[model samples]
Structures are given as C-alpha cells and as structure tokens.
Target: MTTEEIRAEARGQAEAHLRALVGSDSAVLRDDQWSAIEALAVDSRRALVVQRTGWGKSAVYFVATLLLRSRGAGPTVIVSPLLALMRNQIAAAERAGIRAVTINSTNIEQWQPINDAINAGEVDVLLVSPERLNNPGFRDEVMPRLAATCGLLVVDEAHCISDWGHDFRPDYRRIRTLLADLPPGIPVLATTATANARVTADVAEQLVSATGEQEVLVLRGSLDRESLRLGVVRLRTAEMRLAWLADHLAEQPGSGIVYCLTVAATQEVAAFLRDRGHEVAAYSGQTDPTERAALESALVEGRVKALVATSALGMGFDASLGFVINLGAPQSPVAYYQQVGRAGRGTDDATVVLLPQLEDRDIWAYFASLAFPPEQLVRQTLEVLAQAPGSMSTVALETYVELSRNRLETLLKVLDVDGAVRRVKGGWVATGEPWSYDADRYARVAQARQREQDAMLDYLDTDRCRMRFLRDQLDDPDATDCGRCDNCGGLTLSSSVTEAAVDEAGAALSRPGVAIEPRKMWPTALANLGLDLKGKIGDGPVEGRAIARLTDLGHGQALRALFRADAVDGPVPPPLASALLTVMKDWAGDWTDRPVAIVGVESASRPQLVGDLATGLSRVMQIPVVGRFAIVDASVAPGQGAANSAQRVAAIHRRFRLEADVPAGPVLLVDDLVVSGWTLTVAGVALREAGATAVLPLTLGTQT
Candidate 1:
C-alpha cells in the first residue's frame, strides 16, 4: 500500500479507538490531536502538545499507545503529577481496552504486583509520579528495565520540568536523566495546558535526544476557553470576600471548585460556606490520601457545591466543573490560567471569577521566603551531611541544620538532582560531586518571578479584556477579545454584599479560639543537641487555645499588623483585649479546673503585649497575677525560637526562670505569639516544676 493509504488506515483505527474512549460513535480527534498521534506512532518522533484543557490530550496518548502496541511495541510509561490525574487516566485507558496501572505513595502494597505485571507484559501503560523516579529502589531496580523496553514516554504537565514554569518542581528535573537513558527512536510526548513561550522552549530543549540527532515537533494552539466567562470581584476585606461568596456561590451554574491561597483559608472558607447553606469540603496538601480521593469523587458526582482547595488540587483533576472562584488572586497570571482552566471543560458556559484581595501580596511574599535558601545555609547543610558518619535521616539532619522540615526536604531534592547528594535506604548521603551555587541564575529567576507578579497585578486591574489578557500572558498567538467576559458585555458580579451576610461572616471569623494541640512527642535527636530531652514530653502544657492562626482569614490580619517588624511594642489594643476576655469566658465554661493564677512568658519582643494580656486576663477572671518568667540570657536573639524543633528547644531550654511565686493550681500561661511552641513548652515545664498543678496555655496567635 502507498504511504497515504497506510496513514489513512491508521487514522481510521485512531478514530475507532477514540470513539471507544469517549463512548460515542460521533467522537473524532481534532486535526492537531491526530498530528500529535501521527508524530508519536507513525514517525516515531518526539512531540510536544500545548493545547487547552478538555482538548483530548489524553486521547492522543491513548490512541497512539494502541497504534504503537499493534506493531509489537512495548507498553507506554507516563510520568503524571497528581494521584487524582493518574486515577482518571487509568479509568479512561480501561474504556479503550488499554490496561493501565499506577505506582504511587498511596498504593505501596500494589507496587510489587504492578511491577510483576509490567515484566510479564500484561500492562499496556504504567503511571508514576516524578518523585517516584527519584526513589532509589525504583530508579535502581525497575527504571532500567522499563527504559530498555519502553515503547513511548509521556510527561504530563510538562511545564514542571522547567524552572521557568510557575509550578517548577525539582523532582521533575530527574526526567532529563531518564530521557538520556531511553533507547534511540523511542517516541516521547510532553503535554501541558499551561505554558508560555519561555517554558515551552525550555521543555522542548529538554525533550531533544541526548545525541542531538532528533528534533522535537512543537504543536501549539490557541489557549482560549470559549466556555469560560471571566470577571474580577474587588472586595476590601476578608470578611467582605467571604460574604460575597456566601451570598452568590449558590447562584453559580453547577458544582465547581473554590480555590484559596492557603490551607487555613480553605478550612475557613469551606466552613463559612457550609454554614451559609452551601455544601462544600476543604482540601489541601495536609489532607489524607483517602479523604482527598473521597472529596474528588464527591465533587465529580455533584454531591457537593464546591471543594475549597489550595493548589494541591490544581493539575490534572478531571471533572465537568461548571465554575471556579478564587478567594484571592494567585501569585501569577500563569497559575491563574491553569486554575481557571479546571472549569468550563464540559459545559458551554461557565463562571470564572477572581476576588483579588490586597492581602494576596502578603501571601505571595510568604511563599517567596520558602524559595531556594541562601548560599551560606546551603553550604552549611552540605558540610553537615559530608561530615556525617553515614546516611542520616531528615530528622537527624534537622538537628544540625536550621531549616524547617519542608524547606530541608526541598533543598535535599535539589541537591540530589544536582548530584551533590544521593538518597539511600536509611537516608541521604553525600555524593561528593563537585557543585557550585549559581547565584546569578537564581537571581534572574527571582526577578522573573517578580515580573510575573507584576503581570498578575495588571490582570486584576486591566480594563481591556480578561480572557484576552490571560491568553496574551500565556503567549497565545490567537488571543482576541472574547466579547464574553465582564469587561466585554458579560454580566459583572457585584462586589456589594448584604450587611447581614457581612455581619454573619465577621461574627464567624471574629469568634476565635483555634485549638493548639500540645506537642506530645519530643523532636527526634534532641539529646544530640546537648539537651537531655528525649521521647514523649513528660510535663508539657495541656491542649491550649489561640485567638487564631496567623494564616487565618479574620483575626490573622490584625495580628499580622501588630507583629510587623517596624510596629511599636505596646499594650494590647482594646479590640484584642475584648476578644481575649471573650476567649477566657468561653474557655472557662469547659474548664474542669479554673486557673487560680496567670503567668506571662518572657518576650524579647512585644513584652508589653504579653504582660498586658496576662494582667488583663487576671483582672477579668479575678485570678491572682503571678510573676512572669525572666530571660536568663539577654544576648539570645529574638528569633532563636523560630528555628527547627531541636534547635528551638535547645535555644529556649533553661533560658527562662520563674521570677514570681506560683500557687499550687492550674495557671494560664500567656504569650503574644506562638511559633514552634517551644517557648510555651519550656515555660510550662518551669511553671509546673515551680508547684503549679497544670498549665493551660493561651496566646494571641499561632504561626504555622
């Protein structure tokens, strides 16, 4: 048969497979989708597909898998980003008679069986997270075999492979080594719905063959989602945003997602919405795997109005979501596009609204602080690891390093990818590979991030066109005024919320008292730091109460303002004083033993606030004002308590001594702020040793 005749036959088979996948005889692949499939299956060429969501990107891979397997090719390997995405892909593969299996953190028990199935050639596709690629067992044991026999390699959410991408993940960089190891002529496909020209070029460069013999076919298309009607709602306060959502959320077309900038906001918003008669659930990275899966299922089945989520629910969650509302603007326009893309996938018309808050920049700044640590810290971490006798677990390393657990884990991943360290069975070991910190490159990346932030600010205030502005930010050549957004003839949502709604939301938020669970177990390796502490803390403070989390939607703002670096240290304000009294009143009702005395934790900063809070509480509850703890060493820095658990514990251990008399009864231990909770714990221990029966801690706010 002629080449055209063979291509026609392959196209026919592809369409039949697509029909089966979508469960519709009328289903057909778009022209570009077929081109991607043809490039992968027919030409055995590398391809990058940059199309909008719900554009059948998965169909291209599934159909290509069937076509390639027909010619005796091995199974396809997909590096997916999210568990929810992997679950959806496996389900879709089943529709087309393609056997798919996944190995992720959630399914440890099934990994061996899945690996056996792959070896036996019983699985047509194997899905794994990028992090799994770095797993010593998988990379050393299974990856080699799979690489040798892999028919096709797919990188879903390909933008993650580029540091220039908005959601750059260090684990995604491991793909370069895998690509280098793949056999020649193996078709590779990278697909994402959110990538600008810069990110696209970076990913395409990574897609090239190690020998530089293969060129990647780049297929870019318009990023305009016709079904979306975008708008921006400007609200002055967090309560106003909540009230607006409370009043208008049910008016949205269908069940959708409500995205929050932080986990605290997700819980606060979801709870408020539920109270306002909207069925919603909160989701964040902290959620358990089982609960996350159930929440996803609930949203998919239309059992809930929306799932208030963080970026944890961002990539590859498949649902016919009809609306998306952002309580606060994302840090960048690219992230905003990726999130709003989740809506309007199956419906012809969907609502996409952004409620931009002035506080959004504060959230952005907090995330910025978590970026790659400074050079000195990085070098110190490496030196510590190099001097270790053997492999050290993260907890063990934390005793020597000052970084938090999350930040330390992130740095280790980057070091592992850079060959400066290697993850072994028990823990991580120094690789002894020569590595240099690229300060210039990191500076440029930081500057680029700033530019993205500026662009997002422009997006919030732009009067031209919302959809077109987003498309232009993504470098979509086909961007044009959609004439469907609020700026272009669509109905604009009102920022005006009912007074009753605002009052209700404010009341809910103002009603403070977040439970501060006591740390039962001491941090690992505390003894190594020269503190005799180990195992469970014997006399820690009982479960305490704080006015709110520093990340909370309501009281957090006020507390943040008061705790600013330049803010003058003064007595507690009237409003906070009233809130404290209310907290004590509410707390006393549930107390088995009322506090007979109040004691203040010595504060290097905000001493007035701490002392005033304790004295006021004592006066209101008619309890005696006990003496406060005094700092033993005045030379200790103010933020010594902000380090890792072991470090914080060591810094504060024996640093304070009870200066006042203590009655033999429960006492309210007061502080201005609680971070790491080491100060309270140490102070509580001292007070207990001073004859107090029990310690009930209280604080203005808790920093998470």
Candidate 2:
C-alpha cells in the first residue's frame, strides 16, 4: 500500500481506538494526537507532545500501543512519575481494551507476577515509576529485557527529565540510559502539559536517539485552559486566608483542592476547615502510601469536600476537580501554572484562586535552602564515599557528612547522575570517575529559579489577564486574554471574610500543641564516628509535646518571630506563656505520672526563653527547678544543630552534660525548640542514666 493509503488506514484504526478508550461512539483523535500516534506507530520515530492537560496526550500513546501490538511488537514500557498517574493510566488503558500493569513501591508483591505476564506477552503496557528504573534489581534484570523487546517507550511528565523544569526529578535522568539501550528503530514518546521554551528544548534534546538515527517530532500547542477562571485574593494574614477558605469554600463550584505550602499548613488548614464543618482531609509527603491513595480516591469520588494538600498532590492526580485554591503562592509561575492546571480539566468552569501571603516568600526560602549543596560540601561527601571500603548507606554517610537526610539523598542522586557515584543493592558507592562540579551550570539554574520567582511576584501584581500572563511565562506563542480571569474582568472572589469566620479561624490557630514523636532507632553505624551508639534508643525520651510547629499557622508565626536570628532573647511572651499553660494542662491531664521537677535543655540561641519557660512551669506545677543541662563544650561549629541524626547525636554527645542533681521520678524537659530532637534525646538519656524514672519533653515549638 502507498504511504498515504497506509496513513489513512492507521488514522481509521486510531479513531476506533479513541472511541473505545473514551467510551464515546463519536469520539475521534485530534489532528495533533493523530500526528503523534502516527510518528510512534507508523514512522517509528521519537515524539514529544507538549499540550495542555486534558488534551488527550495519553490517547496518542495508548492508541499507538495498540497499533504497534497489532503488528506483533512487544509490550510498551511507560515510565510514569507518580502512583496516582499510574493508576489513572492503567484504568484508561483498560477502557481501550489494553492490558496494563504497574510495578511501583506500593505494589512490590505483584512485581514478579507483572514481570511474568510481560515476559509471556500477556501485558500490552507496563507502567513503572522513574525511580524504579534505577532500582538495582529492576535495572539489571527487567529493564534490559524490556528495552530489548519493548515496541514503544513512553515518558509521561517528560519535563521532569530536564533539570530546567519546574518539577525536576533525578530519577528521570535514568531515561537517557534506557533510551540508549532501546533496540534500533523502536518508537519513543514523551509527554508533558507543563513545559516552557527552555524545558521543552531540554526535553526534546534528551529525546534524540543516542545513535542519531531518528529525529524527534516536536508537537507543541497552546497551554490555555478555557474553563479556568483565575483570580488572586491577597490576604494580610494567614488567619485571614484560613477564614476566607472557611467562609467561602463551600460556596465554590464543587469539591476541590486547598493547596498549602507546608505540611503543617495542610494539617492546620484541614483541621480549621473541618472544625468549621467542611469535610476536608490533610495530605502531604509525610502521609502513608495507603492513606494517600485513599485520600486521592476520596477527592476523585467526591467523598470529601476537598483535600488540603502540599505539592505532594501536585503531579498526575486525575479528577474533575472543580476548583484549586492556593493558600500560599508557589515559588515560581511555572509551578503555580502546573498546580492551577489541575483545576478545570474536565469541567466547563472551575475556580483557580491564589491566596498570596507575606509568609509565602519565607516558605520559598526554606525550600530553596535545600538546593544543591556548596562545592566544598560536595567534595567532602565524595571524599567520604571514596575513603569508604564498601557501599555506604545514607544514614552511615550522614555521620561523616553535615547534610540532612533529605539533602544528602538528593545530593547522592545528582552525583549518581553525574557518574561520580553509583547506587547498588546495599547502598551508594563512589564511581572513582573524575567529575567536575558544574558551578556555572548550577548558578545559571539558580539564577533562572530566581527569575521565575520574580515572574511569579509579577504575576501576583499584574493587571493584565492572569491566564495570559502565566501562558506568556511559559512561552506560549498563542497566549491571549481569556476574558474570564479576575484581572481581565473584575475581582471574581471577595476579599471579605465574615467577622465570625475570622474569629473562628483565629481561635483554631490559637489552639496549639503538636505531638513530638521521639526518636526510636539510633542512627546506624555510629561507631564509625567514634560513638558506640547502635540500634534502638532504649533510654530515649517518651513521646513529647510542643506548643506548636515552627511551620504551624497559629502559634508558629509567633514562635518563628521569637526564634528569628535577629530576635531578642527575652522571656516568653504573655500570649505564648498562656498557650504553654494550656498545653501543659492538657498534657498533664493525659499523663500517667506527673513531673516531680522541671529540667531545661541547654539553649545556645534562646537561653533566656528556655530558662524562663522552665522557671515559669516550675511555679505553675509547684515543682522544683532541678537545673539545666550544661554545654560542656561550646566549640561546636555553627549550624551543627541542623545536621543529620548521627552528626547531631555525636555533637550533642560531647557538648551536653547533666551538671545538676536530679531527684528521681518523672520530670518535664523544657527547651525553646526541638529541631533534630537529638538534644532532647541526649538530655533524656542523660537524665534517665542519672536516675530519673521517666522523662517528658515539652518545647515551645518543633521544627518540622
């Protein structure tokens, strides 16, 4: 058959597949979708589809998979990013009569069966997270087989493969290796709804065949979502934002998302909304996998009014979510666009509101602090790994390094991608390959991030069409005034929250106290650091209480003010003192034993506040002030408190000594703040060793 005749036949099959996939008798593929499908199935070329959400990007791949399989090609391998996305895709694939299975962290037990089915040619599409591609077992055993036999490779959320993208993941870089290993002429497709000019170019460049045998077909389109009505509500206080959400959430279109910048905010906002009779749930990275799935289902099925979430819910969660309200602005316009894109996907009208507060920049700074470490620190990490005899676990490496667990893990991933390290079954090992720190590249990225931040600020204050402004930030060539946004028309939402709602929100915020879960297990291999600690912390403090989290919406703001570097070291404020009394009262009410005395943890930064808190509590509880732990060695370096558990433990082990006499029985341990909790742990252990029966920890704030 002629090429045109063959294209016509393939187009007919694609329409049939599209109809089956959407369960619509009259459904047909868009011209762009058909173009992507044809490139993948007929031309066997690489394709990148950068279109708006709900624009049928998935249809292109699913249809292409069926077309390729009809000619006896192997099952398609989809490198998806999130579990929610995988679930959505699997369901969609089933609707199209395609067999789809997934192997993710959640479904480990099913991996063998899934692999067997794939090998038996019973699975038409196998979805796996990008992280799984780097797994030693999967990479060594399954990936090569899949790469050799796979008909088409799909990289969903392809923008993540580029470090220039708003939401970059190191694991996505593993796609380059997979691409290189693919059999010659195998088709590849990468799709994303959120990528600007830079990210698009980076992703498209990454999609080029290692052999230079095929050029990628780039299909870019407008990112305008016509159903979205964008607006911003500038609230002067976090309390006001909470109040607005409480008073106006139910009046919005349907059940939606209330996005918060921090996990503490999610919990606080969800709790406040629920107290106001809204059926909302809090979600964050700290939530368990099972609970996350259930919460996603709840939001999708409309079982709850909304899910107060962090960016953990940002990526491929599919539902006809009616609205998305940001309690705080994301750091960049790109991130804000990706998040707001979640709304109005399947509806003719959806509300997208951004509640920008003064605290948003502080939150952004906190996240920015976790970026790539300095060159010196990177060198130190490499030296530690190089000097090691075998693969070192992250916890073990933490003893010698000053980085936190999260930062250390991230650095290791970047190093691995740079070929300076390798991830093995046991842990990570130095690759012994010469690697140069790309200072210029990293600086450029950082500068780009700053520019994005500036653009987001511009977006918040822009008088032009909000949608158009965002699209322009994304380099959308077809950006135009939507005539639906608040800026284009008038303010779509009211800044006025009822007095009663404000008071209610204030009361909720005023209520403080977050449980401080004590450390149960010691950092592994402390012996390497000249400390003998290992295994469970048998003598550690029991569960403790903090007046608030440093990230909390209510008392947290005050606590943050009190803990700022430039803040005066004064006695506890009257309001915080009163809240502390309430916390103590509630805490004592549930205790099996009352504290016989108060002991203070040594405070280098807030000695006045910690000492004052201990004395005030002593007077209220009618207990003696047993005295405080002394800083035996004040020689520790600055910022040592923020190090990982092992380092913090080692630092505290040498610095803290119980210099005061302690009468037995339970005692209340007070501190200005609990960061790593190692200071409290060490104090608790020392007190327990000094004959205290039990130690109860109480702090003004806990750094989350």
Candidate 3:
C-alpha cells in the first residue's frame, strides 16, 4: 500500500474507535486530542496535556491505551489520585473495550486477582492511587514489574506532583521515584485541568525518564469554561450566605455542590439546607469509602439537591454538575478554579458562585500550619529514627515526636524523599543518610502559598472580569473577559433574604450545642514515652457537649469574636449564655441524672469568662457553684506541649486539682474551649478521684 493510503487507513481506524468509545456517529477527534494520542501511541513519546475539564483528556489516554494494546503492548499503568476518579476511569476504559482494574485502599481483596489478571494479559489498563505507590507490598512487589513492562504510564491530576500546585500532595511526589524506575522508551502521559504555566512546566519536567534521553511534548489549551457563569455574592455575615443559598438553591439549574472550608461546615450547611426543605448531603474526607461512592453516584444520578463538601469532593468528581456554590472561598484562585470547573462540564450552562467569608483566612492558616513541619521537629524525628536500630512504626515514633497523626505522616513522606528514612515491612527505618532540612525550599513554598492567598483575595475584590482574573492567575495566554461572569456581563446574584428567612437562618445558627465525642482510648504507644499510659482510657470522661464548634457558620462568628486574643476576657455574652441554656435543655436525655454542681477549669487567659460561665450556669440551673479546679502548677499552659495526645496528656497530667469537696452526684465541668479534650479528661479524672459520681463536661466551643 502507498504511504498516504496507509496513513489514511490508520486514521480511519482511530476515528472508528473514537466513535464506538463515545457512542456517537460523528465523533470526530479534535486536533489536540489526536496529537496527544499520536504522541503516546504512534511516536511512543511522553506527553503532558493541560486542558480544561470535560475537554476529552481522558479520551486521549483511553484511546492511547487501546491503540497501544492493539500493537501487543502490556497493560497501561495509571496512577490516579482519588477513588472516585479511578472508578470513573475504569468505567470509561471498559466502554472503550480496554479492560481496566484498580488497586486502591477501598478494594484490597481484588488486588491478588487483578495482579493475576495483569500477569495473564487479561487487563488492558490498571489504575492505582497515588498513595498506593508507597504501599509496602505494591511498591516492593508490583511497581517495579509494572515500571519495566507496562505499555504506558499515565499520571492523572498531574499537577498534584508539583509543590507549587494548589493541591500539592507529598504522596504524588513518589511518582518521580516511579518515573525513575521506568524502563527507557516507555511512552508516558501526564494530564491535569488545573495547572497554570508554572505548575504545567514543573509537572512536564518530572515526566522525563531517569536517563533524560527522551523529551516530553507539552500540549496547552485555553482554560476558559464557556458554560460556567461565574459570580461572587458577598454577604455581610455567614448566616446571610446560608440564607441566600437556602433561598436560591432551588433556582439553580440542576443538582449541584455547596463547597465549604471545613468538614464541620459541610454538615452544618447540609443540615441547614435540608431544614429549608432541600435534599442535600454532606461529603468530606470523613465519609466512608463506600458511602463516598454512593454519595458520588447520588450526585451523578441527581438524587440529591447538592452535596456540601470539602476538597475531598473537589477533584475526581465526573458528574456534569450544573452549579457550584462556595460557602467560603478557597485560599487560592487555582484551587477555586479547579473546584468550579466541576460544574458545567457536559451541560451548556452552569452557575458558579463564591461567597467569601471573613473566617476563610483563619481556616487557611489552620490548614497551612500542617504544611511543612518546623526544621527542629523534622530533625527531632530524624534523630529518633537514626537512634532506633530497627524499623519504627509511626505509632512508636508519634510518642517520641509531638506532631499530630496526619502531620507526622506527611513529614515522614518528606523525609523519605530526602533519604533520611525508608518505609519497610514493619514501618519506617532510618537510612542514616546525611540530610539537611530544606529551609529555603520550604520558605519558598510558604511564600508561594501567601502569594496564592493574595491572588485569591485579589480575585474577590477585582472589578474586572472574574473569569479573566482566574485565567490570568492560571497564565492562560488567551485570557479575556468571559462575558458570562458577573463582572463583565453586569450580572449580580440576589443577595436578598426575606426577613422570615433571615430570622429562620439566625435561629438555626444561634441554636448551639455540638456533641463532644469523648476520647475513648489513649493514643497508641504512649508507654514508649515513659508516661505509663496505655490502651483505652478506662475511666475517661463520658460524652460531653459544647456550645458550638469554632468553625460553625452561625454561633461560630460570635464565639470567635469572644475568643479573639484582643478581646477582653469578661462574662459570657448574653446571647451565648442563652445558647448555653438551650444547649443544656437539649442535652441528651439519656444522662442518668442532672448535674449537682458546676466546676470550672481555671484558665489564665480567660479566667473571667470561664468563671462567669460557671457562675451564670449555676444561677440559672439552680446548681451550686461548688469550686474551681485550681491550677496545681500553672506552669504548663493549655495548648502548650499539646500538639499530640501523648504530649497533651503529659502536659495536663497533674495540672488540675479539685479545690474543695466534690459534689456527690454528677458535676458539670466547664471550660472556655475544648481543644485536645485532654484537659477535660484529666480534670474529670481528678474530680472522679476526689469523689464525684459522674462528670458531664460543658464548654463554650470546640476547636476545629
């Protein structure tokens, strides 16, 4: 056959495959789509695709996998980041006649079978989560073989690999190690819809093989989502935002998402919306894997009005959601854009709105605090690891170090990258390699975060086109005024809330009391810290109640104001006092008996507030203000040396003493805030030892 005829025949087959895959008769491939597939399947070259969401990025990879397999290539290895994304990819691959299987935390039982299938060449594509890249079994047994023999390697949500990316994860950094182990000349593909120019370039660079003999083809596309009608509805208070959403959600085009900054807010907003007669659900990292899948399916099938969520539902959601409303702005515009991108994908029009809150910066700071551990702490961890002769389980190390569980795990991953430690069968072992904490790199990252924060703020305040501002933040060369947005098109959301609606929202917000789940067990490995504590906290305090969470949308603002460092320590505000009474009345009726007296935890900073809360509650409930738990030493202040459970228990171990005779019956213990719950635990212990029959703890708020 002639060369031109052969080329035409190949293109014909590719087009026919696309038609069958999309179930469309006129499924002509875009130039960029064809280019990406040609690079991966024909030229056998690495490629990085930076396109908008719903732009057929998955089609490129699926088609490439099919074509590569047709030529007798082995199964493709896709390092996906989320279970939802993996599920969607597997379904799409199956539709294209590319059999796909996944190995993720949600499906361990299928691993052996999937591995067997891969060995037998029965699976054309295998999807694994980014975190699985470090799983002991997968990393040591499966990854090396896949690296050597997999037909193609694809990194979905590739921006996650770059620290500069808004949603950067330490787990994704393991990809570089995976890339290094890949045999040369294996065509690789990295794809993401959120990367700006810097992140795109950074990720593209990582696609290079260990030997650096091959080049990566960069394909960039405009990020403007024509279907998204972007806008910001600035409300004076969080209650107003909730009221507005409750009033307007029914007016949105289709079932959508209500994004929140914290898990607490997700549930709170979902509840508020439900009370307003809307069908909604809450989704977050806390959601169970099976439940998360169900929730995703519900949203996809339009069974719920919306899913109030955190970033856990931010990415990997494949539904063509019709609207996305942000209850509070994300810290970065890139992050915001990626989230809003979830809407209007398959539809012709979708609404995207951001309701920026004053508390967003505080939430941002709280999360950022966990970003990179301090050099001193990192070194302390390394020193401990080096001294240990054998692998140290994370639980074992937590007792020695003071970081929280998640933070500690993140630090360990970073250390592994720096060669200070290695993950083995039992746990992690020290490599004893000389490693310097990358102070400059961390500082740069911190600065980048601050810059992103500033950019987000600018996005909110800019009178220019909203979409244009976002596009510019992403370094999109074709960024122009998206006429669909509020700024450019003179569109504005109705911030109007009826008086009745406002009153209802205010009542909902003012209604206080969150169940403070008592600590049932002591942190693992606390004995290793020489504290002599182990297992369940046998006589630990029972379930307690707090007036509200500091992150709550309604009472949260008032509580935050009262807790502010600059606020004068005084009596509990009348509104909070009223809320406390309601909380007490609404307290679980299962309490065997009413409290006999009020005992306040002494606070150096909020002495007046804590004292007044105890006195005020005593007067209202007619219970005696028996006595205060005197600070034995007052040397270790609350929250000092309380980063982790062991340290927290140690700090407050003997810190409190019952000042006088305890009440014979249940005693109502009070505090300004329940941060670690250790204070309450130790104080309850002291009371129980002193003679109280039972303790029912009450607090103004619970820290996030």
Q: Write the per-residue lDDT of candidate 2 for residues 616-690, one digit (tens) a residue.
A: 888888999887888878898534746688888888878878876788799888888888888888899989999
Model 3 scores a C-alpha lDDT of 0.87
Model 1 residue 40 lDDT score: 95
Model 3 residue pairs with clashes: none
TM-score of 2: 0.98
Q: lDDT per residue, candidate 1, 469-580, as tens digits?
A: 9999899999999998999977578878999999999999899888878888888988788887788888878988888888888888888888878999999988777777
> Once superposed on the true structure, which residue ranges of model 2 sit more than 4 Å away at CA?
none
For model 3, give the 10-residue run with minimal summed lDDT. 3-12
**Global lDDT scores for all candidate models:** 0.90, 0.89, 0.87
Return the lDDT, model 3, position 669: 89
TM-score of each: 0.98, 0.98, 0.97
> lDDT by residue for model 3 over 1-704, one digit each (tens)?
98667556656777888987898999988989988888888778899999999999888888888888888988899988888898898888778787889998878899899999999999988999888988888889999999888999999999999998998888898888988887777899999999988898899898887777777899999999999999998989877888898889999988899999999999988888898899999999999988999999999999998999998997778998999999898999999999999999789999999999999998898878878888899889988988998999887888788898788998998778767889988899889899887789889989999999999999989999999899998999999888888988745688898777778888888888898888877877776656777777766567899889988888888888998879998999998988888888889486898888888888988899998988888888898978887888777776765778877777776566668678678889889898888888878877887788888889999996
Residues forming the 10-long window of minimal summed lDDT in candidate 1: 634-643
lDDT of 3 at 675: 85
**What number of clashing residue pairs does each candidate have, in the order they appear?**
0, 0, 0
